[model samples]
Target: MEPLVQDGEAVAIEQEAPGDVAARDMLLDRAMGPRWRKKTSQKIRQGRRPADGLAFVARSADGGLAATVRLWNIEAGIDPFGRPVPALLLGPLAIDPALKGCGVGAALMRHAIAEAARLGHGAVLLVGDAPYYERFGFTCAKTGAIALPGPVERERFLAVELVEGWLDGAAGMVVPTGRYVTKSRVRATAIAA
Candidate 1:
């Protein structure tokens, strides 16, 4: 199918076709850096489809997967001090080496964020360089009540609340959907009330 073209650039975002299995693997294998490759591979092995959680891919002029991103369910917001909120988590954002600096990553991010907002997601969270993500309106997750499944530096864990005041008085850990359910310390025994 033809790509979604705009701003003098020929691009497309669409449902991944069955014929894309090989292409998808290739992109995933190279685009994700070392820190994320293992987790990404595990997800693939578990038979997760990009579309299962709003994964959208950016294709190049040649119809190649230049970039891809997935929106997973994550809890974010305030602490018991009154600042936790739930938000869709965006992560493992990857860009094809050849397509780097060509705006593929940016396009994918914009599209994903827009889609999440359209779906009524209260917010979006991710771990990444603050400088790079700041341009997209993401800020260091204040309220500090959330933690990842594993160790993560504070500064890099950022988020963008879709509704301005959505996270104003909420608190909780941001856990992967189904991976944690207590609404408390996802890795421990904390709970939200």
Candidate 2:
């Protein structure tokens, strides 16, 4: 995909690659710090990849990683009527400290949301600053009744319905519904090694 030009800079949005893993993690560390590992979002992402075709990074004109965003498959638990509501969890949208307010994060959000709509996804839930995400159409109006498995500032839990009414009456705990990577788990034998 061609990079989007904002403020005379080319910010390319592309699928995150296997080769980008180390750099991605490092950028995340720099952006989020060690405390990132202790968040409720970390628990949901601990052993899974982003939802298929939903992981993306913003690269600077020189090809350095500038920002990252990931979406994960999750259940908004069961709705009020007891039907399961499939949804995507968007989070940890980390932008390089140096690139904050450079429009990289906004570009990533637009691209991801557009892609998700194209892929027929319904709703997206996230824990984020309402003022920041509200620009992308996320609102607490849809998330008022939803909860996370761990402690979170209730006001920060927000949702956006890619499909109208997707979040209507959908309320419950959000849980990881994607493939959990077992390869990263250290077995007892490996622990002794």
Candidate 3:
């Protein structure tokens, strides 16, 4: 059922249409099912926020949505060589569960990467499986030199270079873009309350 396109043809993967949040929510609900809630319940998810970088979804030639992916702007900090790691953060990349095994996810991922690269990003950072992400040239950042406030699979905190070897001299911790500061403020208020 994993099809890259209808009959091996390329599907037009593009940035989500204007005001597609509802559709994105619905898609996540359907694709993730109950697993979404449990994962959302984790406190770590609160502390460790991925920055919004870019998003792409697979659509039929008729414009019917098939799958989705999103990116966030995040910082990987400075590397051993005092260089900053500029990265596009990706997450909640869901393909309709029904579309699992189909090439929808792959198409969206490829398109997303291409878009970010076109936008001049240094790398992509995501929390995902080693075996799964390996297909896209990603590797675990266990020794990566970035820190996370919450728990994540050591091997799953990964980064992929948009420019070959972009990470060679960069090292540091990942932090949510501006959103993290907002969340921190909210948390602080809650604590004071």
Candidate 4:
């Protein structure tokens, strides 16, 4: 991904690396506060690996983490016939408090969304501010019939289809379908349950 320049600072967007784990977690905590782990999205992500090649981060010119976003594999819902609807769940897109509104978050979002499309994902679901995500083509148009495992503000549920009509008839409860992380890895990562 390309570096984004904002207010004379250059922030490079890149794939999340092993070394970025601690920094990313700290950044997320700082940006979202301690309660972020209890969100409904976390329930779906617990014990699962982010979809392959979908986790990303932004680093400032000083090499400090600036922002992060990740997409998880999920079943949006089962169709009437009962087959799981495969989709991507995006969440916890956090930017360092200092970097908020500096375009780092936007850059990372664009990169992640484009990469997901490149990887042939059909759609992306998220619970977020409709105003912010709408700029990325996300809306609740197709998410009305979809349900998460826990409570979420109705207006906050959103989706954007990469392949036109991929979510046309999607309905039922959204469920985690990503590869499970090993117990040891989960313990090391301390993934929120």
Q: TM-scores of the models, in the given order?
A: 0.73, 0.91, 0.74, 0.95
Predictions in order: lDDT: 0.65, 0.85, 0.66, 0.91
Predicted candidate 3 versus true structure: per-residue lDDT over 7-52, tens digit per residue: 5544577667545656765787788774663552222334443334
Candidate 4 residues 1-193, lDDT tens each?
5678988998998889977887888898999997888999999998788999999998899999999999999999876777888999998899999888888888899999999999999999999999999999999999989999999999999999999988888899999999998888767677532
Q: How many Å off is the CA of 178 in candidate 2?
A: 0.7
Model 1's C-alpha root-mean-square deviation from the true structure amounts to 8.6
Top model number, TM-score: 4
Sequence-dependent TM-score of model 2: 0.91
How much is the lDDT of residue 114 in candidate 1?
84
Best by lDDT: 4
Task: For candidate 1, write residues 27-141 as lDDT tens digits.
Answer: 7668764446455223322322232447677776777777777777655645456543556767677777866777768878888888888878878777888998998988875
lDDT of 2 at 187: 43
Q: Which consecutive 10 residues in model 1 have the weakest lDDT in total? A: 184-193
Q: Write the per-residue lDDT of candidate 2 for residues 25-130, one digit (tens) a residue.
A: 7888899887887899778877776899999999889988889999999988777789989999997899999878888899899999999999999999898899
Clashes of each: 18, 0, 16, 0
Residue 13 in model 4: shift from native, Å?
0.7
Q: Candidate 2, residue 179: CA error in Å?
A: 1.2
Which residues of candidate 3, in runs, are more than 4 Å off? 1-4, 7-11, 34-53, 81-83, 141-143, 178-193
RMSD list, candidates in order: 8.6, 3.4, 6.3, 1.8
